[model samples]
Target: MGCQCSKFWVCCWDSEQKGLVVEPPSVENEENSEADDLPAFHEYTIDQLRMATSGFAAENIVSEHGEKAPNVVYKGKLENQRRIAVKRFNKSAWPDARQFLEEARSVGQLRNHRLANLLGCCSEGDERLLVAEFMPNDTLAKHLFHWETQPMKWAMRLRVALYLAQALEYCTSKGRALYHDLNAYRIVFDDDGDPRLSCFGMMKNSRDGKSYSTNLAFTPPEYLRTGRVTPESVMYSFGTLLLDLLSGKHIPPSHALDLIRDRNIQMLTDSCLEGQFSSDDGTELVRLASRCLQYEPRERPNPKSLVAALIPLQKETEVPSHVLMGMPQSGATLPLSPLGEACLRMDLTAIHEILEKLGYKDDEGATTELSFQMWTNQMQETLNSKKKGDVAFRHKDFRAAIECYTQFIDVGTMVSPTVFARRSLCYLMSDMPQEALNDAVQAQVISPIWHIASYLQAVALSALGRENESEVTLKEGSVLEEKKNKTA
Candidate 1:
């Protein structure tokens, strides 16, 4: 193993493992070679992660279990427009800093198509976080239990099981055999709609001893007696997962076994999967699940054997997962609104007209009320800077506008969403999308309901090639504008 230690944290990777370590493995990743590859591990600072998640804003949180869960997960986008999922552990969760780093780095070495690979981690002061590939479609629980659109098809369920088994096999091959709390929630669908086992389940939270959150009757018998987890425990959990897929519910292991022994496949099988598979296929799956849930830990099927058993059961093998799940293909770009279209086409003149029409009306109430008695020379300088920025902006001198706007913002004499919006457009015109995004975000912070701020943000995001985010932001702007028009 190759180790890279910094003052904040330690990152290690297996030198022998070949392939570039890209999080959210892409289809084109198959062509990666040993010669042109970067290390699979990164050590991210807490600040970087905070910026990505917008200071851990409430809206960014995506953890299904919600506040009740020990750790919180947030959806974030990196500066490069790469989406990421960041898991922030409770302060006391990882009491041993060294242990947290070791576990994170060890897990970071793994990169597999079947896994939501760990990209990096942050261990600063009392904070401990793990960053991984963001899976857009959400967890198996949502689709399997709380689905709104349609029930998960039989082919997709079989694929999930097979892919999970493959993930376990891959992790075992890499000498990371133990996975904690392997449940439906641990399985998330990626942008391609393919099921991937979450890598976060691989590392045990040192401070949290009660690993299994489910009822003791459902937990592996060995775990109840020993208060420890083993590879067999993971197999037992996998059996529960299979039961979940089969029944579309959280049935206790003993109860499921009884139902299976009574030859009541009808009772155990999901109602929605009635006409999907043959009797033989159902029997084979039940038999596999029974073996996995064997009373004797030694009798459980290993991940390799499990994968072998599941391989033949996979149906519609050639179909893309997105099609099977009835989701848009990863390559499909969402249709943009008029504002988003203008932004994509870089129609600065059109954007300028919109800004001019909107004016600084949104900033009127937000600007600091400075009376003549309290006004200082510093305030005058700030106002002069803003005046200069507006003039340069009107003349299309983006560079000069950015400079003057920076001075005005630095003074911090007053808050103006309009000024920030103008500066954001100036940055976009100057071909600095990231800076433009930051300024636009700041404008929104100053005036939360300002439609112009959201519109500017959409343009900046589009320039950054974050089309999905841009579409959402542009739609938000349109909504705010409509609401304002109605109220007016």
Candidate 2:
């Protein structure tokens, strides 16, 4: 009888028949369109869904809704006796309903071995429900920490790692999957103990529209600066997940640096595994994890490379049958000995070699100017430090050399004539004429006898619109050079 729009609900009545008629694109047409484009269900009355979920009883609630984007998930038995996980979208507090709807539709289309399948959806009036295949074993996070479940065997953990990497790779290959808001809580373990990537609520398409909160421990610094989520950023998150799986401890934002600095394998290894897993493999995993957590995203491996690196480890060792058989687990702690450390180093080197052989660096090479800039900056920082500071400032290192020289000036360290002259050359190499003049001025103050510095200073000042000063400096330097040459 009426059609609803943002402004108002409209109904038309025929005076002759005293009947009401509604004229708008039929609901059936709209529903069919939604179904054809993406899987969506006809609106079921809220009463019907409430009944299906046993009146939204607490007992039926499988998991508590998340705080960032809250939604109630209930284990419901439909009238047809099909059991499902009913995710009720919280429309009241959500800022953009249409955007959320678009995200749900896009994520619903992603079907991969590592991804959890979207079953269907229900959009009835103000109530929106997403129906997904129920993950029987709950999330990997819950499985890992739940007292009722056994510790995840090392092999399974590796499988999960590889699975996640492959999923990310698949999403990236499609060129549609932007950044996944990944974390332990989003990884669900099925009855087969295989991990499925879930929680597409935060998923974004290639169009850069989503704004999700950052998990500081798992998110890389680059992602923080630019909203761009590279495969490397996902790899970083996976690496953090690997560490969490090993240690059985929640990695805090504060401890991230310590984990990298200490490289303590024992600190991250899961106590539940009782050190039963191979110490060598554990150490290797930890090292990779640390690499993933590198402050620089470029240092981290891509998801595809990470998958390749982890998959072989599974082949190298036999899965402990007893652990899989559900044996009475024992308590034993594995210590990180020198051998474990060596093995980890070997594994990392092997990964590097494999990556080199694959022409990955050649094909992808620091091809992006941004990547090159980051590399140059890192080189500069290293050269500036006292320990490795003396490395030659080659043409390649000129950017870094200039940066160091500039910093030296800012700190009032240009006391020596030699230092000032060197800094002047560095500034010249960097195309900074004004900076060169300043350096040359300091050099002349220290020792005006430096004819080369004077000449360079004149050139710099000339470039900087100080023609008079430039001429004066050049004449003085020429006279001094002649005098010195005659004396020699």
Candidate 3:
């Protein structure tokens, strides 16, 4: 039997066995050498995953497209206080559980600083989920396209392109060459605000081959006919990303190429990025993008080539990503409002006083609450439970307060955001941050604009070691409080 051989592996005929034989590949590679240094990949039980995601709550959703997306991505915190991004596949996504595990574990073996590496996966019955390190800063699409404070700087854009190219190169070297739906949304920024390629795109979504979520015209031309993605197709998508960084818009590759051909660099560039980069630098990026957008997939530059081309184009290499993006650093302390200060200090006395002052004033406008006029036994029991919980909370008896509040909530006789908020604080005092966070979210659901609920959530999130989410929630609470004061 004739057999083939490669640099990594060998196949040969075994005369003794009278059959072809394949030998395991050599493990003498640097990537394999660093395996022990990487975080251990976990096989999470469905229960653990559910608890992490608060039973797949809607508020935890962090995907760009929300629930309408094919596979919804959620933000969650593990019992270990580590934040994670969970991608839950639809029921129809992975009918073959074994195949799903194989793919997830294969991707999990890969660890890179430029990628949001997969930490674990859960596949039990109809449920399928992938857990990865959570990125605190928002996605590239939000910063580049729908920016609120300021558009992404030219230096940051260059860094993003280079980092993403390096991510692709690393994945290719690890034998995972194809990436699906490589777009700005697929790029997320970490706590340091540095861009990283999402690892989720590396897994082949078995859902009927509709991979590209962008305009059909912008999709790789070959995918239109084949209904499949190849490594070169990934390059084509990268070209589109380059165009996006240039224009700060979703320009179809064909149109972008036409603009490049016409020497309309000025017109193609983002208005916000004006005066940032020299025309020479812009021309060089445009030239590279044009090659990646070539009609023939074979002509497209490989990931290594893309990395080589992008490395020289990088700017502000010495400046940290968070500083360049004007985002608050991990150690940076924001001025805290009175409520935030109390929460930070865990001054239960101050928090209790503040809640007492708030005193159901926001309750009068609550439309979700059941009418309190009913004299049924259930209503009386609900009121009595809340009264007892309040007394326990006042006395700092958090355990009893939690129990009483649970009874009141489970009875479903009335909707009291105040009761939920009190229970949340009690849970915080009880050292049950996850349950506290859940109750705080439930409070927000009952009263959408209540600042106290947001404040409690911030405290719970902080206890859970999710500082980024905590800061955002704290800011939201301050805003809502200000709005309420103005209305008052």
Provide the overall lDDT of each model, using Cα atoms, as 2-decimal numbers. 0.79, 0.55, 0.79
Give a tens-digit lDDT track for model 3, residues 96-198.
Answer: 8898999899999888888898998999999899999999788999999888888899999999998898888888888999898899999999988989999
Better of 2 and 3 by lDDT: 3
The TM-score between candidate 1 and the true structure equals 0.79
RMSD of each: 11.4, 30.8, 10.9
Give residue 461's lDDT in candidate 1 (0 to 100): 81
Q: Which stretches of candidate 3 lie over 4 Å from their true place?
A: 1-39, 45-47, 64-68, 360-375, 391-417, 420-488
Candidate 1: worst 10 consecutive residues by lDDT?
Answer: 7-16
lDDT of 1 by residue, 1-488 (tens): 01112210111112112211222322232224411322367889988888777678766788844445768898876655466899998777887888889989999988887889899999999999999988989999999999989889999999999889888988888899999889998999997999999998988754766577656777899998898999999999999999999899989999998875555556787888867886556656766777788888998878877777787789999999999999988756545555556665769788877776767877777788767833688778778888999888888888999999999889776778888899898888888989988888777666666777777877888887788777766765776667777799
Clash totals for all candidate models: 0, 3, 0
TM of each candidate vs. truth: 0.79, 0.51, 0.78
* Per-residue accuracy of model 2 over 99-144 as CA lDDT, tens digit each: 6566566766665556665655665566777666566557777756
Q: Which segments of model 2 are wrong by more than 4 Å?
A: 1-48, 66-69, 93-97, 199-218, 226-231, 253-257, 315-488
Pairs of residues clashing in candidate 2: 41-121, 246-270, 247-268
Question: Which scores better on TM-score, 1 or 2?
Answer: 1
> Which pairs of residues have clashing backbones in candidate 3?
none
